[model samples]
Target: MTNEELEFNNDEEVLTLYDNEGNEVLYRKLLQFYHPEFKKEYLILAEESNFSDEDGDIELIPMISTDDEEGQLLPVETDEEWDMIEEIVNTQMDEPEE
Candidate 1:
């Protein structure tokens, strides 16, 4: 994989992740917020068309970036953290853009 494919940029608004088996997956940025308790940055992403689920609902995946060349993606490890992130993303997504 090239360097470009391995990295994610907020300016680009889209992210591509490679699986362990070397398959390329894509996701679009839906929301980004900072966790007040953990003091970490997080992103909520909608899986791209090719990776979407059977019901056509855009699956949201929450991740934290390691900020390296590989752009390592890590999930919110704890239930509390996941709940907090989920609520924040949902609330933000429901608001209208001004």
Candidate 2:
């Protein structure tokens, strides 16, 4: 789906993606934050019906970029980067939202 087609409900954002079998699946944006060191925005998403942390707060991180003609989502690489991102997310979640 195109960036302009993104839909938001309440405070969560929705993105449509295709599975290996090319079936459409919906994912919800849980959190979005910029990495100071990387200077890139990242999205934390959870798959449909898998939104709770009851089992575990499983999330996907995709680097967000608009420099391309269309928006781009890239996978996060390196354990160090993932660790930093997680730390940032945790820190932000602990604070009150304005």
Candidate 3:
């Protein structure tokens, strides 16, 4: 899909990838779903490609320029932060009667 056709749902932190036929192929959360290597490759592609519009807003592009090196760095959320998030999710899930 072309850069213009891509969209980012920042509220959900999801990257919605589309097929050549304009069908949704994948939905991945930026913080929760993607592998570190894939994220790195995405970053490299974004760095190398020239965007037609530069209006200071972020855009999602489905195509990856594969000539670039793959990125392999994982996110660095601390254990405490992860634990807190886990606790929050668990608490929400465990909530019972009103």
Candidate 4:
């Protein structure tokens, strides 16, 4: 869905994706940014139901992006990709939100 078509609930954008078992799962799009090194766009998504960690803090999981036509969110593979994702995310977290 396009960004404009994204539905927001409680001030968060929600996207519905089906799991391996074909069950619908809801996730909140916490962040989206282009990875300069990888020349690809990535997203930080947290499952709605599992939004919080055991400590009741927001858990950001999965730095996902795929080149496939479907635009499916696939987990990034490789140390380099992971490192880049972490670095970008950390930088984002440190920046004061406007």
C-alpha local distance difference test of each model: 0.67, 0.65, 0.33, 0.71
Model 1 vs truth, CA RMSD: 8.8
- In Å, residue 72's CA in model 4 sits off its true spot by 1.5
RMSD of 4: 6.9
In model 1, the Cα lDDT at residue 34 comes to 55
Residues 1-98, candidate 1: write the lDDT tens digits.
22232222333277787778999888888766555457666777876864457776667888886667976778879998888766666666676766
lDDT of 4 by residue, 1-85 (tens): 2234332222358889998999999999887866554677778888899876788777787556677898788778889878866
User: What lDDT is obtained when candidate 1 is compared to the true structure?
Assistant: 0.67
Most accurate candidate by TM-score: 4
Model 2 lDDT, full chain set: 0.65
lDDT of 3 by residue, 1-98 (tens): 22233232223333444456997544333222222323312211122122234774323322322333652233334565345334433443355635
Q: Tens digits of per-residue lDDT for model 2 on 14-94?
A: 888777799998888877755556667677777866766697766654455435765667778878778876676666566
At residue 94, what lDDT does model 1 achieve?
Answer: 73
Displacement of residue 63 (Cα, Å) in model 1 is: 0.6
lDDT of 3 at 73: 32
Using lDDT, rank the candidates from best to worst.
4, 1, 2, 3
lDDT of 4: 0.71
In every candidate, how many clashes are there? 0, 0, 0, 0
Tell me, by lDDT, which candidate is best. 4
